[model samples]
Structure formats: C-alpha cells, structure tokens
Target: MNGTRLRPATFKYIESELYAYPDYQREINKIRDEIINGQEEQDENIGAGKNSYRKPGRPTERTVTRLDDNKRMNHLKEMVHVVEQVYDRLDDTQKKMIQLRYWSKRGANWEYIAEECFISRRTAFNYRKEIVGAIASKLGMN
Candidate 1:
C-alpha cells in the first residue's frame, strides 16, 4: 500500500489497541524513549570513535534515525484520534473481536476467538472478516 493510506491504518490500529488499556500507553512511551535514547547514545559513541578520516573531509554520516519532539507528538496525537474514532463506532461484539485479535499481546487466531466467544471457528472467521471490512469502511481505509 502507499504511504498515505498505510499510515492512517497503522495509526488507527495502534491507537485502538493502545487505548484499550491505559497502562499500555505508559509502557509504549517508556519503550519508545528508551529506544530513542539508546540510539542517540550509540550515535554519540560512533562519532567519538571515528577519527581516521580523509583530510579536511565533511563529517561522517550518521546511521541513527531521529525525529524532533514536535513531529513525534503530533503523530501520537493523530494516532490517538484515529483510534478513538474507530473504538467509538464499534459494537460490543466488534470491539471484543478487535481486542482479542489485536490488543491482546498473545495474538489470538479465529479458532481462539471463536472458542472464547463460544462460536464455531467458521463463524469466528466470518465475524473477523466482516469486522475488519466494517472498520476499513468506517475509516475510509483500504
């Protein structure tokens, strides 16, 4: 998929999954910060260690990826909004299906969701497909 379409779907899925449990947001933020800090430290170490370059050359290329705080915050905010919208429209059954399939870290399949919901596996698969289609349609996603 193209970047523009993929980003919204990703944001929606992330946001919806994250909001299901408030503690998840805190954990995610902490993990993100740690990753960013680790990258920054690694970058600093690399810069300090490299000294034998060509005479009067341009600075060595950096390998780490970095995002300014404003951009990061804006992306997070957009994700939160997208998730909230998706969550609001869902019926209880659809919400539970989404939560089971995505929000739960264990990552349940149709058989599992069906067993949990006390339905046949085929029914579970159909429900999942229908819900996914509904979510995509509601969000104007692919």
Candidate 2:
C-alpha cells in the first residue's frame, strides 16, 4: 500500500465522511419529502392565489435548473454522489473493511478487525489507505 497522495486535511475529511453516509441518505430523503410536499401545496393553491392574471411566459423552470438553484440541496447531492461513486467501486471485502474500521462504534483495534476480515493488520491499513485515496480522487482532492 503506497502512502495516500491526498493532503492531510482532505484525507481526514474523507475519513470522517465515511461515518456520514447514513446521515446523508436520511437528510436527502427529508429534503426530498419537503420539496415534494411544498410542490403539492403549491399545486393545490395554484388557482386560488390573489394574483388573478395568468403569466403568459413559462409556467415552470426546468427541473434541473430549479434543483440547481437550491444551494443546500445541490451541495448535499454533490457530497453524497461523489462518495457513493467511489464506494460503489470497492469489492465486498473492501467495503466490509471500511465498515469495521470506520463505521463500527465498538472501536475495534486493527488486529481484531483484521482477524474478523481474515486479513493481516497491515492489509487492513492498506485497505483504509486505498479507500481514503479513492474518495479523495473522486472529489478531485488528490
């Protein structure tokens, strides 16, 4: 395992983000629901608004442009999308290595994690470097 070429801050940020995958999905779902519900309410009130004049121009902006206009939503989607793309490229054991090393609250030592994964401790560390390097590359931080 060659040392990661990522800067220290970038490496740490990507390492921390491994723990945020679940939270990101939940937030995405919540924001998605909010957008859907808000749109539905707007649809329900469309004809009853005080402004009686129907606009002669475009009824709605393109969905892509409208989504891009939302800074928070766009930021979250970009973060999640980059990580997921990198994660999906890993093999199953590599994913398991990540789960044991980062996501496990048990704070298991490398020895224990390696034992569980049937790999050496050095291999476990190598897997971590690879994972972090992949994430950094995907984010254009490397």
Give the best candidate by TM-score: 2
Cα lDDT listed for each candidate: 0.55, 0.72
Query: In model 2, where do residues sit more than 4 Å from their true spots?
Result: 1-4, 39-66, 104-106
What overall lDDT, based on C-alpha atoms, would model 1 receive against the true structure? 0.55
RMSD of each candidate relative to the true structure: 9.4, 4.6
Candidate 1: where is the Cα deviation over 4 Å?
1-24, 27-69, 120-123, 126-141
Error of 2 at 15 (Å): 0.9
Per-residue CA lDDT of candidate 1, range 39-125, in tens? 433233445545744334222222123333445544555545665676687777667766777777446667778777777888766
lDDT of 2 by residue, 1-142 (tens): 1454777888788877777766777887777666555552134445666776643444244344455577777767887898778778888888777778677654668898888889999988888888788777767777
Worst lDDT 10-window in candidate 2: 55-64
What is the lDDT, from 0 to 100, of the residue 4 in candidate 2?
Answer: 43
Specify the poorest-scoring 10-residue window by lDDT in model 1. Answer: 57-66
* Top candidate, metric lDDT: 2
